[model samples]
Target: MEQERLVLEVDVRVAQPRAPRRGGVELDPIDRDLEYTGSLLTLLDPLGLLGGVTVVALSLTHGAFFLALKTTGTIREDARRLGTTLGAVTAVLAVVTLGWLGLLTGSAWSWATTVVAAVALLAAVAANARGREGWAFTGTAVTAAATVATYFLALFPDVMPTTLDGGRSLTIANASSSPMTLQIMTWAAAVFTPIVLLYTGYTYYAFRRRIGTQHIPEPVAVG
Candidate 1:
């Protein structure tokens, strides 16, 4: 199941590798280059940081999420206790990421992007406080999506830029693969992704109910 989902995700990304441009409104070299530089040092990296941080965030997010779902009414081994610990850690990461984002982008920030990120952080915290499982997970998803979208949108053409020599920076216009390749991947994704999604959804529905200690039979003693 995880493998199928990953395959679908790879297809999705392959179909659309180049991120959003800065609405095609070119910034002067000073502004354009500085924005990228500031953002980079502030912990947003194209080839590395965002993806790496996102994977960590997603793992922490999943830890909290499943803990919320499967732990309700499960007192034998209080999953919420572990879930709370995970939430605390994820919250710390989220706060740090949010702070990193604000340090650079807040002043030069787009209100839409910044606001969503802020709201996401707050939502996660609040949902956890109230034990709202769905909302807590939703907040994590929003936080990841909004942060990624904001960074990519701001990044625009440049795929990766360096302070040493801005001349060599990679950009979407130059870095993208062939259009035909993307189209082929798009068709492939369209064929397989829905099936994977359906199966995943069905499994979740099948296991929708909460579990308790009684669900686990006692262990037999060994001879």
Candidate 2:
């Protein structure tokens, strides 16, 4: 009888639900939270790409204007040729970098892209150092445009992918924010964007003149 009773007690104890342990560290919860945060952070990169693209476009347009202002009726044909060649080379390098990033995700591609971009960038630096101002400016403009395009192309899928699941995912995540918060952010941007544009325009206009040995003022005497 005691043996049967002991067996019954063991069975009852085995069938009872016990409270989960508190301290051993579960991986699933941590992994899930990390994944959620990572997705949120990924959205920022696309916005950053868009911002960079806008800046590059502005710089290129302003730079062309600056060049025209500085060299009006004075630029040699050779300088124009050099500038065009430099721009073309830099643009090609930029396109290669963009394609490399989009198609290749491995270490070899990464290294190759880095080496090519570095070479092109170094060439531009050397040209500028040699007083090839037009070439330098053209290279800068092309490089910036390429970089912006590459980043945008990579990040666009994260922000707004073609896949239905991706769109739904972003929608859910984005909609989690409060309506009042969204409204405030929208209003703030509306108020500040024009101010930013005006300030940027003013800065470009103020610095439009070219730096030349003759134009540089002598250092003021100091006590």
Candidate 3:
């Protein structure tokens, strides 16, 4: 199932590599280069690919930690083992990728988030080692948050850099909606955010119990 999903993802990426560029009025250097090359292989940016892999590793590690927290017996033991191994891999990949991004961006905010992400990942690994699954989950959550924050902080001010000489880059100032639109969005978010949060919290609370193989029903053979 995982392999099939990955294959489908790759096919989608190959078929619609420009999906990310849609709805953007201006092109960044990488996007412009992609356009110039017009090849599916051109989508392979080493740093970007590393970052993507790091995220995937982090997600897998997170899932393992979650399973360790919510399962019993052999399944929990397996989850712990898998989580530890994947956490180590995630730490290495995250450190390299985030450090590279921090240096490339050269911003205090980016560097700060990079450090936070590294520290969070380390904490998660340590927590998992100590059999503290909850803390491990929290740590991985923080790491994911920090990673995303670093990316956005690095891209601040200028949403996209100009590829052509003398071309105006897409900036937050240029890309932002009108004040009225912003106001409406702010009000709407304020009104709906709490309701959404309440619903999510209640949903999680309802299904918070741990489960094991014993909970599974035997499949009835239809003759």
Residue 101, candidate 1: C-alpha displacement in angstroms: 4.1
Backbone clash count for every predicted candidate, in the order shown:
0, 0, 0
Model 1 weakest lDDT span, ten residues long: 23-32
Candidate ranking (TM-score, best to worst): 3, 1, 2
The most accurate candidate by lDDT is: 3
| Superposed model 1: Cα runs more than 4 Å off | 1-58, 74-78, 81-89, 98-111, 220-223
Model 1: per-residue lDDT, tens digit, 1-223? Answer: 9999999999997784232223231222222333442332334333245446645855676566666666546551354455456656665655555455454434455346756865875677567666776677777678777777666655565555433333345678656879998899999999999999999999989988877766888999999
TM-score of each: 0.63, 0.39, 0.77
**CA lDDT of each prediction against the hidden true structure:** 0.59, 0.48, 0.81
The sequence of per-residue lDDT tens digits that candidate 3 reaches over residues 53-130 is 999999999999999989888898899999999999999999888877666664898999889999998999899999
Clashes in predicted model 2: 0
The alpha-carbon deviation from the true structure for residue 81 of candidate 3, after best TM-score superposition, in angstroms, is 1.0
Task: Tell how far residue 148 is off in model 3, in angstroms.
Answer: 1.2
RMSD for each model, in Å, please? 14.6, 13.9, 11.0
State the displacement of the C-alpha of residue 109, model 1, in Å, after optimal TM-score superposition: 6.7
Candidate 1 has an lDDT of 0.59
